[model samples]
Target chain A: LAKTTQPISMDSYEGQEVNITCSHNNIATNDYITWYQQFPSQGPRFIIQGYKTKVTNEVASLFIPADRKSSTLSLPRVSLSDTAVYYCLVPNAGGTSYGKLTFGQGTILTVHP
Target chain B: EPEVTQTPSHQVTQMGQEVILRCVPISNHLYFYWYRQILGQKVEFLVSFYNNEISEKSEIFDDQFSVERPDGSNFTLKIRSTKLEDSAMYFCASSERSGLAGYNEQFFGPGTRLTVL
Candidate 1:
């Protein structure tokens, strides 16, 4: 498992773009950068995932640099409903680990009206 | 979208009592996992199951915790003896494939809030 570091909290307003960055200096070659979102009293939901470069989906985009030591989750046109805790994980996606997720404290994003 | 489902949105029990948490994973998912989160704390992985057997577990799983796929559609976690420390939200998740095949994106359930006194 690769340890990840992220901001404790971030604030954003409606219609604004929010970017959260995670640093995992010890990420492994077989590891993939994954992000999850959790609203109050709910389970973590998968947002986006990527191995390298950039990957975009209906909800968000993941940007991984060439070094892969860090990654960024970019959310466009944020709304109050988007307020949640965002987790950045570097899980070994090609080993015998069985895909168990290890979550950190995560970055709490609060969207204002 | 087919999502994982857990039973007993909330459960209250006494210390030393046993409790079973049940989950119905996505119909096509092959891998199942259990995770817990104490209030204001990070979510912690308890165990992972595949092919009706445990594939991995954290130190927290210990002897008190056990998992079973009693039938084709249901997966369960049993705590033989509950402690005050066991009070937390238990989340059940399922994945279509294991890490061995590369992509292993897991879908999570709403979670069971367990309160032990």
Candidate 2:
């Protein structure tokens, strides 16, 4: 697993779009960017993932540049319930990789009223 | 809406005592993992199990730590001799194996908070 850095906290309002950026300068070629959302007292939930370029899901979008040193998770139309810590992971995208997640200090997204 | 389930949301035991944390992974998922987080620290992986065998483990998974899938639906992490430093929130996760390619999303269960005295 590659080391990642993300914001300590972020504030947003309901109905707004929020972007959380994570930096992983040493990410390997085989690594893929993956994001997860975790609410209080709950396990982290998968949000989005991408190898390069852009990937969008019903919940969020992942934007990765050619360098892949960093990636951004875009959550549109955020709600108060979206208040949770978001984690960025560069999981080895292939070949015998299991869920050995090394969670960093996630970005806590606070969506207020 | 399938979810992994963990038992005894909270467990309190004395140091040197054996403790077992139980989890029921999603029915169809083939890969299972165990991770723990101290009160204010990041989550750390303990071990990963598949095909009823240990695939990978972290340095934290020392001699005292073990994982077992006793039945069809249950995956258990057992600490042979718990320690004060072992008190933490332990999480269980399962993922569906999709070939050898990457990008399999792991589904996690509500964690078990283990308190060692």
Candidate 3:
């Protein structure tokens, strides 16, 4: 499994856009970047995933450069309800390592009024 | 959309006692996983089950830990002997496919808070 590093915390205001970047310099060929959002006292929820370039969803957007060394999760017009810890994971696609996700400290986003 | 569900939202047990955590994955999902999060720590993967067998597990999933489907709709994780270190939030997740098979999205349940005395 490739290790990912992201900001420990971030502060954003309501109605503003927030972007959290994760760096995985040793990403494998079959590795895919997956982002999960975890609110206090709840389970982590899937936000967005991407292999390269850009992928957008109803909740957020994931951007991965061609190098695949890093990726960014962008949340638009954030709200206080969006405050949570975001985890960026890179799991191998095949073999035993498959389906085993190693989570990092995660970026805790704090939305304020 | 159907989501994963867990039972006994909270559990308190004594050290050396046994405990079973239950989960009901999404009806159509094929892959099931168990993860634990210690207070103020990152989520750690324990095991993943597919097709009635374990596909993979982490070092954290030692002999003390076991997973069973038991029936058609329920997946369970059992700890033979609980310890203080076992206190944490256990999360159950399910994916439509294995990571090798496709872009897998593992949906997670609210989690079971296990406290070992």
lDDT of each: 0.94, 0.88, 0.92
Q: What is candidate 3's CAPRI-style docking category based on DockQ?
A: medium
Q: Which parts of model 3 are misplaced by more than 4 Å? A: none
Worst 10 residues of 2 chain B by lDDT: B97-106
lDDT of 3 by residue, A2-65 (tens): 8889999999999999999999999988888899999998999989888889999999999999
When candidate 1 is compared with the true two-chain complex, its DockQ is 0.77
Give fnat of each prediction, in order.
Answer: 0.76, 0.66, 0.63
Off by over 4 Å in 1: none
> Interface RMSD values for the candidates, listed in order?
1.3, 2.3, 1.6
Residue B17 of model 2 has an lDDT of 100
- Which residue runs of candidate 2 sit more than 4 Å off their true CA positions? B98-100
Residue B20 displacement in candidate 3 (angstroms): 0.8
Candidate 1 CAPRI level: medium
Candidate 2 residue pairs that clash: A93-B102
Determine which window of 10 residues in candidate 3 chain A has minimal summed lDDT. A93-102
DockQ of each: 0.77, 0.63, 0.68
Better of 1 and 2 by lDDT: 1
